[model samples]
Target: MAKKPKSDPNYKVIAENRRARHDYAIDEDLEVGIVLMGSEVKSLREGGANIAESYAAVEEGELWLVNGRIAPYAQAKTWGHEERRKRKLLASKRELARLWNATQRKGMTLVPLVLYFNHKGLAKMKIGIAKGKKHHDKRADAAKQDWNRQKARLLRDKG
Candidate 1:
C-alpha cells in the first residue's frame, strides 16, 4: 500500500486501482517512474486520473503502462495529451528482467496498483506482480473478514 506522509504536501495519490487487490493475489509490488507529458502532469496534479482499468506490461524489453487515463488539462487545449495513452514506465534493467520472467514463465500479471506523486513531487506508479484469484478465493476472504470482525466484537463485549 502507498503510505501518505503526514507532513509532505506533495505526496498525494493521483489514482488508485482499488479492485486490483480484490481480483488478484499480489506477490510483490515495485514503484517505478512514469513518462508523462506536461499536460498529463498538470491533469494528474488536479486529481484527474484513473487506473481502474490500467495494467503494466513488459513489451519488447521495455515496460509500458497501458490503458491509463489522465484527463486532458483544460488549460492546455492546444497541447493536451491523450486521455488513455500507453505511457512508458521506467525501472532498472534487473527489475524489468525479473518482471518479464514473472509474466512470461511464471504466468503472473503486472497489475497497476497505485499512481501517485512521491515526496519530491515526481510521479510514480506501484505495479504488482500478481496472480488472478478465483471466485471462491474472494468468498473465502470475505468470510474470513466477517469472522474476524465477529470475534473482535465478542471479545470487546466480554471484556
Candidate 2:
C-alpha cells in the first residue's frame, strides 16, 4: 500500500528565489495574490514554476509580476498558457501606492521572494522591497557566514 503525504496547515511553497537574499538587502515583505490562467495553475500544482529571475513592478497604478516562468501543462496541449508572461498582482490601492513610492527611490527594487499556495488553495506571492547589495557586501556576508559555521564547530568540539 502507498503512503499518503502529510498535510501542512500553512501555505505550500511552489517556487522560491534563493538568490534574492544574496543579491539584495530586503527591507520589507508583503504577500499578494497573482492572476493566473487555469493551465498555469495546474502546472504550478505539479511543481512547474520558477521565480528565480522574476520581479514585481508597479505600472500604470497596478503591480505586475514579470519574467516568471510557469511551464505549460503537458495535458493542456495548445491551450497551455505562455511560459513567461507578465501576470497581474492583486493589491489594494494603498498598498500599490506604497510600493510605487518605495520603488521611486534610488537603488530600491521589488523582488519576488516566493510563490506559494495558501491554506485556502489560492496562489500568493511574497515580494520584498529591497536595495541592491554591493560586491563588498556580498563578500562580507559570506565571511560572516563562514565565521559563524567555524564558531559553531569549535563550540561543539569543546562541549
Give the top-scoring candidate (lDDT). Answer: 1
Which segments of model 1 are wrong by more than 4 Å? none
After superposing candidate 2 on the true structure, give the runs of residues whose Cα lies further than 4 Å from its correct spot: 1-10
Which ten contiguous residues of candidate 1 have the minimum total lDDT? 100-109
Compared with the true structure, all predictions reach lDDT values of: 0.94, 0.92
lDDT of 1: 0.94
lDDT of 2 by residue, 40-142 (tens): 9999999999999999999999999999999989999988888999999999999999999999999999999989988788999989999999999999999
**Clashing residue pairs, candidate 2?**
none
Error (Å) of candidate 2 at residue 8 is 2.3
